[model samples]
Target: MESSSSSYLNLFVQETAFYNRIVLGTLLPDIAWNPLPHFFQTWLRNYIGGTLLYFLSASLWCLYIYQIKRSVYVPKDSIPSNKAMLTQIHFAVKGMPWYTLLPTVTEYVIENGFTKCYSTINDVGWIPYFVYSAIYLVLVEFGIYWMHRLLHDIKPLYKHLHAFHHMYNKQNTLSPFAGLAFHPVDGVLGATPHAMALFVVPMHFRTHIALFFVEAIWTTNIHDCIHGKIWPVMGAGYHSVHHTTYRHNYGHYTVWMDWMFGTLRHPIDDDESKKEF
Candidate 1:
């Protein structure tokens, strides 16, 4: 058992080094970070990479949804003001470094064999890989559901920690930038499920990393207020309502949680007409 654990650590070290050398080194060669300890490299890479991904993805999506497709998605007089967007961007940018720390620490934990994170899909076979991935998602969804709900349900948690996120309480103030416009702790708590699932379920290392990055994209999508009309998905439409009502649609990724918890509010049921410009 000790030998097996050591092997996993070795693989983690090698993979992390290779990633830092190839990916991070190319982008941040001046930093001379490749030779640093694996933990530091992970921290640097996640911070840099996460910040870039957040800005780049949010910018492009904002362009498409707020500009290119504005007439198609954004309702007349419902477009967020420039000042509102800038505020969201400010909060998001300010929170990114602290938010990235969660994943960096999560990687460190997984590297030290503190979590059930496998190095590769082959270790668990194809069937189990998919099965485990589903399990991880479910665990994350459930955890985030309760975490988000409790953030509102508990007065102190909501007042001190989560209230910062509720500043954009309307469609006209919400935008792609509002996605990560959370207090550092608020944003981290919302995503804490991803890391927490590591200790509870077997997760593919690559899948875990990919999902974390994918979250950057997903959050932006759900904040755009453009309903994708995809059933079961907790899309922007539902999320827009959540902003206004403050008491509904606390689920992430899907509506199953809200539905089960009796907090689900369908976008169609919302009195706000989905009128496009």
Candidate 2:
């Protein structure tokens, strides 16, 4: 009788475990809640932080640009007020979309079946969050670096599609989204490729969040023109050169690719070969 009791107890425990897995799986894929709440909290914090940083950095850059404009382009007799200059900067940056539909579409694609190879990364046991993030970052960066280089190659395409961004002929924090004002072909080719990389690479939620922040900060930094001698050390000045000349400096996140392919240059050099225009 005691032996019979032991068998029945073991069977009951196994059945309970099986039932619990079914319940949890039905509710959440990883037995975890959707992180939309957490994502919003983090996004709000970053948005606030980014706004503060952009204000200070952009102000300094605007003042620098104004000084350059006054010396080279503006009449010596008319000194623009700081308020007037700042208004221009504010309008330029604010007019562009801060949050975009491309990212939302990319996320929806990932949640659906656009690219499913990355799903296995979530199942890898013993992998830490940071490791997964690092992998995704490397993959996305590699993809973007190549795609940006490709965009600058075809002349007819570049002029018609990407000409609006070069319209600035100078750098500002507002320049990244400034491209949004471009032809629809430019928008689709320039932004969508990198946005879609997320769907191609299996990324964890943490990695996706990190990528968003990194891309935003880097994009703003590349367009800010106040880097001076400190810019090259931080990899910020090349894009400014690209703006001024309109032909070189195509890599989005890093200069290494540009350097390797003979596209990198100093901001003031008149070397037309280095210029992408």
**Best prediction by lDDT:** 1
Instruction: For residues 1-277, write the lDDT of model 1, one tens digit per residue.
Output: 9997798777877776676676687787645885777788888888888888878987898888778888888876888899998999899889988998998899888888899999978888999999999999999999999999999999999999888878988888888888899989999999999999999889988889889999988998899888887878999988988888989999989988887877888888543322310
Each candidate's TM vs. the true structure? 0.94, 0.55
lDDT score, residue 254, model 1?
Answer: 93
lDDT of 1 at 230: 81
Model 1 CA deviation exceeding 4 Å by range? 270-277
Let me know the TM-score candidate 2 reaches against the reference structure: 0.55
Off by over 4 Å in 2: 1-99, 116-132, 171-188, 228-234, 268-277
Name the weakest run of 10 consecutive residues (lDDT summed) in model 2.
171-180
**How many steric clashes between backbone atoms does each model show?**
0, 5
All candidates' lDDT scores? Answer: 0.86, 0.50
Worst 10 residues of 1 by lDDT: 268-277
Clashing pairs in 1: none
